[model samples]
Target: MPDPLGPLSTGILAEAERRWDLLTAADPSLRRAVDLQRGLIGRSVQLFETIRTTGVRAWPFNLDVGRLRSKLERGVPLLRDESWTLPVGPLTDALLDFCRMLEVSGAGASAAHISQAIDSKRLDAGSLLNASLARADCDIRDGAIQLGLAPDLLWLTAELAVSPYAYFLQRSLAASLPPDVLSTWDRGDCPFCGSWPALAERLVDRRVLRCSLCAAAWPAHSGCIYCHEHGDAFSSAAIDRARPERLLETCGACGGYLKALVSDRPLDFPLAAVEDLATGDLDAAAAARGFRRPALRKLLSAQTPRPS
Candidate 1:
């Protein structure tokens, strides 16, 4: 499948390969993770075309700067207003393809189990996709348990499949919104998808949060992103004193940690994962210190209604 974004996807994949080579060379243990990520990036590029040409429907947005401000003030993400109904045909195709890719990427028996379940009609791909979009964690967990699959693995695969669609919707929604609306978003979570930032990019003196899901970028708070704790509880340390540009920011109050890197600019969409992978050392450092990244924030809007 040719990449829909053509030259853009080509550049992104090339950059990803460059980074992966450096990361794996520095730490050979990252080989498996790098392989998985490489496959995912390639598949996502293909799916980007699939999503665009299939005419998927994005959730409608008001696009009023005032309404956007109100939503941001209340900690509601921009797309949280209405349930997004993804086209089942494209979504199902993406999910099945990802499942097969996972198998080829050495996901082991769990991947096979999911594939078998879907193939045998024991699992409904559309239902699983909708549940994931709705943030219906319990349903997903139950379905996984019933199918004798690892819940986390199943959820991760579903999330991976849904991500390209989310990316497409977010880009569309973002383009329609006023340019300055994102500036008013102060929450730790992504103003677009409510996912915690994969990492922070420090450009000059300001920190910008990069979304793990849709790869959206937004300004970050001065303090701890999880709890708004800016006191002494919020502190950072460089993993390598010689390289202060790469550091881990930890919030003692919430026991939450975020990896930050000084960069010339925000990372391109989807490439944020590459940065996150390259900084695995920071994640290890934070874990060694007993700090951790927080779970995905379930938006209040996720509970509104199921997608049609």
Candidate 2:
């Protein structure tokens, strides 16, 4: 019999099928958007795997940012057209809002500045928001704010970080990952640079954490992912212990929170990244109190992946 714990694991696929049915029934649009996002996220996961297993470390997880940015700049036009109406759905609407911000922010920004913003992770959040509002001919300053989002740049930038287009950009850059990288890797988190994770996941029985850049995933230690604090020595708790399906893995020492999903059996799905995106609300709730993914958000930070 095949190792059901592996990527092609049957348990994982069954879980995915079950959850997918529920998701599709609840919100077909969400399922569609997730399907699209999965491709991007999956490519990222593979890239990080390559970096770790290959031992062929290069600049920025062996990525060439300049070349990557140039491609994005050139491809933006192709990504849109007169008849290419933006997708409309819950997540798509959110994505539209984010794209508006990018368009607005990039309008007055020099190409060099735009590139710098992406690189420095200091892209103007306000400008992006304003621009997004402007494109829609709506006044964001007066728009109703909900779900902790303000009519400001910060909200817009956050949207961009998780945007589908950004995922596409990251995936495209990830193609540079060597085929043998995973064989050399010991863990995830942008195998090349060793940066803190954008998110952590529990896929069936494996614990995987991924880097915000270079899109890597590797096995995570049981203790605090950031400080390597392990066992009962470090404080940890789940939001609902009885409901194993949902968990909030928080480390009081470093103030990091990563969600976990417990299942009766293991899974075959790409559980780590999938779970992260699926449990976005948990991330939001954690961030509400100032707890975050415990990683730097600037482009310079992307230059070198940090240690978890």
- The collision pairs in model 1 are none
Model 2 agreement with the true structure over 1-308: per-residue lDDT tens digits: 33211133355545655665666676675775566444443443343343333432222332444533443343221111112111222233343334443444443232233334433445333334223322221233233132122344433333343333223323433445444434333432333323456565566678766554324455676677666667563544455556556767776677777666554433212444455566676777778856766533122211221101
Question: Which whole-number lDDT from 0 to 100 does residue 98 have in model 1?
Answer: 80
Model 1 lDDT, residue 154, Cα: 80
lDDT of 1 by residue, 92-150 (tens): 77777788878887777788888788778788887787666655566788778877887
Question: Which ten-residue region of model 1 has the weakest summed lDDT?
Answer: 299-308
lDDT of each: 0.78, 0.43
